[model samples]
Target: MSVESSAHTAAPRRVVIENCAIATVDARDTEYTSGHLVVAGNRIESLGSGPAPAGLEHVARRIDGTGHLVTPGLVNTHHHFYQWITRGLAQDRNLFDWLVTLYPLWAGIDDEMCYAAAQGSAAALLRSGCTTSTDHAYVFPKGGGDILGAEIRALAELGMRFQPTRGSMDLGESHGGLPPDTCVEDTDAALAATAEAIDRWHDPSFDSMLRVTAAPCSPFSVTRELLRGAAELARAKGVRLHTHGAETVEEEAFCREKFGMGPTDYLESVGWLGEDVWMAHCVHLNDSDITKFAATGTGVAHCPSSNARVAAGIARVPDLLAAGVPVGLGVDGAASNESGELGAELRNALLIARLRGGPAALTVRQSLRLGTMGGAKVLGREHEIGSLEPGKLADLAMWRLDGVSHAGLADPVAALVLGAAAPLTLLLVNGREVVEQGALSRVDEEEIARNVTRAVTRLHGG
Candidate 1:
């Protein structure tokens, strides 16, 4: 396949990495104790055991991957990138109380603030071995000034594959929603903006670096009309749908009181459950809800740390997996998950599943899969970006396992998911290095940190 070049003059370059432990995360759970992977342009040319074949032609860069474990880069299924600058607020509050406190604060956001926050969020994700991420950006202030555009620009600059939803919340506090009036939009206007975003940014190519989704914020924060409209818009435009659902018991109660149904049922009523739809949380899903999700091919973005931080109950992840519902890990937003590292969610998902369903609930490899293949499935990119197979997008993480954090584990996957977040040796998105030596390669970390500080100061009126 031909790759796009910046100057539109040269063909794509090829790179090789040898002497690493490769965990393909493929259908058969393939692994190589020592192997070599060749990347030609934005696709994996080939990968197999032992040294690379002699006289590999036209090599541009070669990396010695000793003491590293290479896996398909972790994919983040849900996040609020704008939440990076607004972390630490509403710490002691549940979902409802937290939104009540932060809605006004978030309402002041603009393009400048979103660009800075998105960079900070992407920086954290890149360093933590995440190469692909889907952001649910719903809080569009009236004069937000290209909020979605800002996010798209920031991630594009950083060279990470992005799927950002044009999310909307039309139900304000007056309408029994959690958000303040200023943070919500009109139903028709929201739908129009969502469609506009897709036209402007969504790329559906096999090696697509950016795609757009239509997201109505959540069951409690959106009107039933907005939910139905968003689903229709996304399907008509051939884009996926995303939203928050079943996040907490309070949300369940809100749905029951207002819509006379549970969150899942309300979603299904509005045509929001399908292969193209993936909901965040699903923390309060019942057995029937799980069955519905599986039967309809609805996916879930399991945000374990954020759920725990907000006192949301443990999600029935093991049960969902058993019922054949696709499950993926999410760092959520930085406000609820301050670390904002997708790599850590691998460990958190494992522990949370085991906490709810005992020791055998989720294995280390399963945890890694949740962050990789499962996430790819949720976002409808499974065939293109999930695994490290030939012809797949060359998006993968080279994790360093020789450090103090993970030196002695026999199984590299064990040290990765069961232990603390393993530091990345490199992170590749579309065969381009977004991160190297655990730092962003395309931008300066210090510059990103400074921008975040400025954005925070502006947001807080400091």
Candidate 2:
């Protein structure tokens, strides 16, 4: 089954998907072989087996899902969309060295570069079955004007559900931080800009296309004062908080030497270890830290590919899950992971979990949950867009099982995670199709690639 076109229209506000295998990642983890789902006005109206609803039969748009596998659209809990411009550069470096090498180039980013990079990255994610993502754009060059705003505009054009974090790094080398002075910002200016972004873009309603989070880049690059202030401001404004935590042993040593405690302790001292916060790359944490996270409802975004690429240690995903901590998958940054494909991230997650524990450490269903429902839980969006229920948003991905990769797979749903990554036949967010026939419908892929290449050339001075 394939969608005819990717044209954006509201004429057919209702759609019925008939005769597909549905993996509903709901509370019960339900699965149906010959299921039917109805989408009406940006929300799922109903779903079951045998027949469509009475009124949905007359809907204009009907997608024949004879040989397709449908599931909730995957959610990416953490990313740096602008890093798509720097893929394959600094390939052999560790975390600290990679950041130092790329900071200067990132300082050269302008409004156009941000737009192109965000568009390209979002396009890649859509093709890989991600309908919702959180972009951590923390670099604020000295003279760059509203780079976050440009990123938001570009993502909107792609029709993706975006959470653009107002990320900051106010501690520079002059202040004993990793980033240079030109790459950091004044604390007052950063706070004000964050508030402005929240006021201008954040919509806390159901099925909102855009939301904002306050993220101070990381422990070594930001000040303790900024962390405390950002958390207070986010809570006062009713937004979420995010940052990098416990990613490396070197980072743990730095936190201990600088703050007189471990990463998790420092986070608590700054009043950031709470339910409204989610941290990226928690690859190193003590047993106590895991207990604290489970107790406080803190979330972790696991970036398996980036961790392996940088020689960072494997994260304790099975332990975290057993402890009842909310854990989600993340494609940290295109430069580090070298791929913004969320489906590939899902596969890496399964392999890495089994590598650390045993073959039974992570199942295909569990990994799929981490990419979908677990991600929604991380972002506090489980109520709206995680599963395919009657009241949930119409965000879904359809993969055709007719391809060679899945030719003889007996279980199509399991093949999606255990088999090779496959292109999405159709991707819908808020009842609007963004990808159709294995291509982005709203944006021209070739044009986005060309613009991103031009931006990278300009930044590299070639």
Candidate 3:
């Protein structure tokens, strides 16, 4: 069980993983047992379960994964990385009320809090076998913190792909938005800062690990002009756009009460319906709305735990997939979920889908696909990473099924989802091991924990 460090250590540029069950979540979620994956550089050079490839037998070093599950690294499509510091607050409230209650506390956040929370959230996600993930950090307190830059730095230091959006709030409580006046930004400043983030961090390359996005918070927090301006600016800067939409019934009621339309129509009016745009928590779209998203190439980030925790109805995820809408899984913000584990949410996705659409609705393959492939599509990084196919970035995880949770399991993929364990054995981002043998190999855990403690204490007025 001696895993060679990388690229054969010295002789060759390859990693040969043999005798494992590789679950390739391609167009079809296929499994091949007793297989081998030849990793050269940052791509899977070859993979199959038959006789070894011609050159594999001559590789420098090899480790056998006799009873392990080697799958594409999990992708988290949506999150508020900063909310790791704000966990366990304003619970039991609906979406709008919850935002109102937490806005003041979030306004108190500074750069240190943002960095600690970002690092902590990304670390937890990586621990949960996730490689590439997205962060929708939208609470930019005026004159308080460098939240976006800090998030980028945290992700860079941890060696994970980060889609840190420059989320802004131009409309406040005084102007009928969720945030307070102290937290909201002027329209000019918001747009300017978004452009600057794009210039500084937005990398559109195939192997990029850091990307910038423009997110104007949500419907109730941003004006119509800001939404259109965000889209225009993002397109001009060649980046993507993201925001919250149709998350709860309260949001629907607010749209009807305030704008006299549904959330889907609200998106259309604000020029936010198209490719390169994905909205989070679309739990309340109708048939026509679903068709609109399908036709327009819009993506949805389905948050099962957060929805059920807040008593929001389950998203029509099966229906959305059937209707051709690109839907992915998200753990949502920690303040709502309290735990940022994509594996747990994948289990919840299956359980909740079964509760709604009966058994055999959301299959185990579909759940993993949503987390791996569907998530890559949602975050607009499908070509770069997601599956264990060749030419994709070397982002993956190995779940050692010899543990207690997966005891007596025959099928490795099934054991992986049902096992309910986070922080996988080996996690890699761009061919770099961030979590090796169930511990973080990327950043400092004790330092991050100390920073998070200080941030949380400061948040509690200590």
Candidate 4:
């Protein structure tokens, strides 16, 4: 499938996916059997099964999505875009061994590599039906590099909504942290960069293009003081705080050994339990921790593919969702999952939940919901971009399902999860098409693969 087709119409025009079976996921009449989705000026004007509103005749361009799965653009709550260059190298290793083997390679990253990796990952994600992504780029590697700016620029070119965390790895092995000293940072520099990112990018408005969350890498990679300070700094700036917590049994052991407490206990002591916080992985949480997270409105980014890849236990996603935990989907990192596709995460999430909680435990709708609305809840952007209502941003994905795998399916929604990735025909972010016909609309994706290939060769001595 080539993406160089006519894009349904000419550019600099009002685009509409007309006669599509619109699935708004809104409160009333959410599913439109066959209707028009008018994207006049970056927002859905009116979507329903019946005729359009009074004067919708002025749509300049229209693409028909009659046999497609249309929904709110999927949100990626967690990711390390830079890791796309280093995937599959440290295979069969647990978290500690995994980090140990990869840290050296990661220490060599510059802004160019970060930009290329983020562009590649963002293209892959959009091709898999994701429209918005939040990247956790915590590894600065003590260089004169601008990784965040590179990634932000790439995403801006792609027209994806970006929420990057000013992540820091302050505590080195000398300080009982996981990263080496080269990858660690001084406390003052870390805090300064955090403030700089927030001041430059953090947008509190509803139609924000990019936002910065102060992220200390994890419990094992940061100090208690750094964690508390990051939280305070985030609160002062009104941004979010993110980190890793209880991702594996080994992490649990590390926390108990280092802090004399579990991961949740250490986080709670550091005032990390709050509505403005969300953690990645979260595979080894206890019952009490679940309760605390739910009560405090803390969110979790559930990464089934990454957990299973490193042999981390399958997170009790069922229990977490049942316990009122705001659970969202994450690919974690390409190094762990080897696949950064957000729709791939949906498939893994659905299957893994069913494996643990039986067939009725997770449905296709629920899985897709997790990637969209659930992710928005985790990011506190639910009211803005999760659904396909009129007021929401026109961030959406259209997966064509006319293939044999989905041809005979009675319901499009059911076919979406079970179908063979459904073949993304178009992905829109803020009414702009970033991907068309399963390829990036802007940068050369094949060139990205070639660059990453060369980068990997340099990374591990070819």
Segments of candidate 3 deviating more than 4 angstroms: 4-12, 51-61
Q: Least lDDT summed over 10 consecutive residues: which range in candidate 2?
A: 2-11
Q: What digit string (tens of lDDT, one per residue) describes model 1 on residues 1-462?
A: 112223332456777888999999999999999999999899999999999888766677778888889999999999999999999999999998998888899999999999999999999999998999999999888777999999999999999999999999999989788888999999999999998999999999988999999999998789989998999889999999999999999999999999899999989999998999999999999889999999999999999999999999899998999999999889999999999999889999989888889999999999999999999999999999889999999999999898888898999999998887788878889999898777799998999999999999999999
Model 4, which residues run further than 4 Å from truth?
A: 1-13, 27-29, 458-462
Candidate 3 TM-score, true structure as reference: 0.96
Reference-based TM-score of each model: 0.97, 0.97, 0.96, 0.94
Per-model root-mean-square deviation over C-alphas: 3.2, 2.0, 1.9, 2.8
Error of 1 at 281 (Å): 0.4
Whole-model lDDT values for every prediction: 0.92, 0.90, 0.83, 0.84
What is the lDDT for 436 in model 2?
A: 93
Kindly list the per-residue Cα lDDT of model 2 for residues 216-299, writing each as its tens digit: 999999998889889999999999999999999889988999999999999999998989999999999989999999999999
* lDDT (Cα, tens digit) per residue for candidate 3, span 1-462: 576543335533566778888898977666797788777666777888864577453354466776678899888888988789888877788777888888888888878788899888988888888888888877777666677888888888988877777888899889887789988888888899889889988888898888888998888888888899999999988888999989888889889999999999998898898878899989999999999999999999899999987888889899999988888889888888887878787788888998999998898888888889899998888887779887788888888887777768877777887665733667778876788888789678898899899989987799
Scored by lDDT, model 2 comes in at 0.90
Question: With candidate 2 superimposed using the best TM-score fit, by how many Å does residue 238's alpha carbon deviate from the native?
Answer: 0.3
> What local lDDT does model 3 show for residue 269?
90
lDDT per residue for candidate 4 within 369-452, as digits (tens), equals 888888999999988888898778889888787777788888787788766778888888887778888888877878888877
Provide the lDDT at 88 for model 2: 93
